[model samples]
Target: MPIGLAPTVRSKFEHHKIDEAALDGAPMFDLPFNPGVQIRGYSAINQPNCQIIIEDFMPGTEFDWTFVHDEMQYCISGEMEVEVSLPPLYMETTKAHITPGTVFSYPVGARKHVKVIGDAPFRHLCFCPPSPDYPFPTLEQLKGS
Candidate 1:
């Protein structure tokens, strides 16, 4: 009943293939204007030291501005446009266009938005540090929640 044990259980399970089909029919977060499928995620080093999530963005849909402890992302399937806002400075930097196979990382307090284009969906993986005070709510509890 202690923390940081789920990852061990997950590791014990067989590794499965990562493919579009595997992601199909998956449950995703739908927030009015934003549309994306959250494929899979894991709590790093056990219960929740860090988390990794794979998302598929629908065309014209976006993940709105939100702050995190820290984040790193990689484009795995399609194209996207990312807009980031930094705190203290309130400065906004935008990556107008990004294609498949691109990778990037952001600081702990960055606010970010993601937009997908064309008919194809944008698939990417996100990494974020585990912190109790992360502005964005953690999905860690959803493993049971």
Candidate 2:
């Protein structure tokens, strides 16, 4: 039998109302590295191919992230130190001093780390490829500490 590939829109229903007031009241999760850090996100609006996350990192806090899938990050505010690892063949790592308006992409399974160095909070928008492992565990998963 031939399978249909038509696109369909998913409704949030009453359980998830789309209101400015409700959205303003949405809960945010704090980053484990810094209690003052927080982030909020909603499911992709019109596409099933990506998800958006907004992250706020407090000054002096560092976050190490390992991707389960390809991802892109765009800095929105403040400054940070970004360290990215190249492929095994290269065996070289690159570091960038990024500030608001910087954008970068990481290959699937790439490992990256960031440190908030500016006095202001660092904020960024992250987009991840859609996958069964959409919400993967933190880097602590393998650190064993």
Candidate 3:
């Protein structure tokens, strides 16, 4: 089939990665957008071409905005509703329910609205290519919750 496998094991891009537990002490940042929502994130991978982060949004939080980087996200836990639309005019919306193992992506400039959908925090792992024009949050931007 087009997708290539049943009960998918891992992404073709997967490689031996550092343990996520090792990043437990990494600094957290009150990520931009979704203001007032208890959403926090910390870099788990900061490579020259790309970066990854584990981000969590407390229940009822909503993040609605356009993308500045091409990116992909995988739900690690909890649930979410994401609405994405291509730019030029983000008039139409494509919504999806994101659960464990759900993977989604959007091109740069696509508009996306994501809402944390349940009691527990909605957590996901996000990956994006690094760009000097719009850099990722630095550890210095960390703050106590």
Using lDDT, give the best candidate's number: 3
Model 1 segments beyond 4 Å from truth? 1-16, 32-47, 131-145
**Global lDDT of model 3:** 0.68
Q: For candidate 2, list the clashing residue pairs, or say none.
A: none
Would you estimate the TM-scores of all the predictions?
A: 0.63, 0.62, 0.70
For residues 55-80, what per-residue lDDT tens digits would candidate 1 score against the true structure?
A: 66777676775564677778887788
Better of 1 and 3 by lDDT: 3
Alpha carbon deviation, residue 127, candidate 1 (Å): 1.5
Q: Supply candidate 1's per-residue lDDT for 124.
A: 77
Query: Clash pairs of candidate 3?
Result: none
lDDT of 3 by residue, 46-71 (tens): 66566777767778878787788898
lDDT of each: 0.59, 0.61, 0.68
Candidate 2 matches the true fold with a TM-score of: 0.62
Q: What does the lDDT read for residue 141 in candidate 2?
A: 26
Candidate 1 vs candidate 3, TM-score winner = 3
Winning candidate number (TM-score): 3
